[model samples]
Target: MFGWLFGRRKQEKFFLEMMKAAAEGEGRRKLFEAASMLGIIIKGAGTDEEKCAQIASGLVNNLLKASGTNINSNEDDQFVAALFSVIACSHFSRILTSQFELSAMLSWVILTAGDIEKIEISNQATEYYIDMTERKAPVLIAAGNSIAKWVNQPTAENFRAVVNVFDHCRSMVGYA
Candidate 1:
């Protein structure tokens, strides 16, 4: 039992560090590793709804906080997109859609998807949006509303990101 407890602590440490690395623009391997850990925790959370929710919330919070940073590199954009994809693909995704915080974070992701200067970042966000749509995640409507709001914004920032988001949102309308 002590061994199990100790191993859990180690896993937690590893997971936290990887998440930090992913958010801080540390490295790609760490980003993927952290994303993989999230995937494992979520997939293994069968029948453990609280555990799944906690992990999902933590990841979303982290990503939202990290999004405050000005993306400095293509890898940074990829890392953000990767983290978003992991959360978007999770079994808890549908439930997360109903959550105000998670939905807001997702909306922010869609708003920022207009960062088209970074092609990979735009692509990744678009793909993540598509995946969420395919899952029929309930957040699509909230995202659509958010997209409409962003569309009216006067700033040119993330303009392409908005266009991409518009395309994905349009595709998801009939299905989601």
Candidate 2:
């Protein structure tokens, strides 16, 4: 039956429950579920811009609290890192481009993780900054300045990656 396949009402209920769990801090299960939902939303077919922004905002707000407890705890760190990875992924970059809050959240995630040599997250954040610079150069330039502070200059790769992002942005503007 179509109902068996879709289970639309059940899906809705599940989503609502997940949202409640995210808000109530029902522990790692809820946090992980919320993070997974964000990944799905970012990677899902079609571009529902408004819906994506709303969901991303909610995820960012919920995870902010989760990040504060025991940064050195592997369990906590992994959960936060997974959520950060989801937010920083390429798919998420597109979903977040139109939303200032989501972009800011992505920047925050990168800055927060940079100290630990989180190259993947940093790369994604740089890519986002590049994309945003192309879309709204002035806004991203200002944002880039803030992101600049997070770079670990002692890490050659990280320094080069940041430079490359700026270079790429410059080249795009030159052609335009």
Candidate 3:
């Protein structure tokens, strides 16, 4: 669902695609397993405000946690891509805070199996993510970088590299 980024030009294109995919489509239990590895509690939105930063960091760092079924395999690409898409939506949900509908919690998340309703919920959340991207939200830049990290080796070193770029984006002081 995303690409490995190199220079600024490729980064822009990758961000565009990541944002588009969010406007589209889950493994909640598996996701929690990965999240907990980084000490993220997955409090869902509307929980304690103090937990927001933790969730945010978890959203970013979990890219390297490899929440998919088979790490370093082609099969895992979709899994990681889906996770990044959901995290992108979650970032917007956190930005929206309240009145955000079910956008934040991934609408019961993507981990449940064989339950048609949950699958629909997960798909709906994806649509939410996608629509937000259509709106061209600024979070797309950082969100794209998070997914782009995986397109490379998916190592912590690469994760840190993308995160440093993300940090640089955050540190910008002038108008875009």
Give me the candidate number with maximum lDDT.
3
Ranking by TM-score: 3, 1, 2
| Residue-by-residue lDDT tens digits, candidate 1, 1-176 | 56666798788898899987665443323322443443424334333333334443344433333344333433544444333433433433333223433443443344345355544554565566667668877555444433233323323343334334433443443321
Once fitted onto the true fold, the runs of candidate 3 whose alpha carbons sit more than 4 angstroms away are 1-26, 43-54, 57-87, 90-132, 135-142, 145-155, 174-176
lDDT of 3 by residue, 1-176 (tens): 33453877888888888875553212323333434545667554544322333443355445334332222233233233333436544543433342233443432233332334445444553574577578876655565655344332344565566555444433342211
> In model 2, where do residues sit more than 4 Å from their true spots?
1-61, 64-70, 87-92, 97-113, 120-176
Cα lDDT of model 2 by residue, 29-138, tens digit: 33234445435233444433433433443443333333343323343343333333333332334423345444544444433543454444444544655566568766
lDDT values for all models: 0.42, 0.41, 0.43
Scanning candidate 2 in windows of ten residues, the lowest lDDT window is 145-154
TM-scores for candidates 1 onward, in order: 0.24, 0.22, 0.31
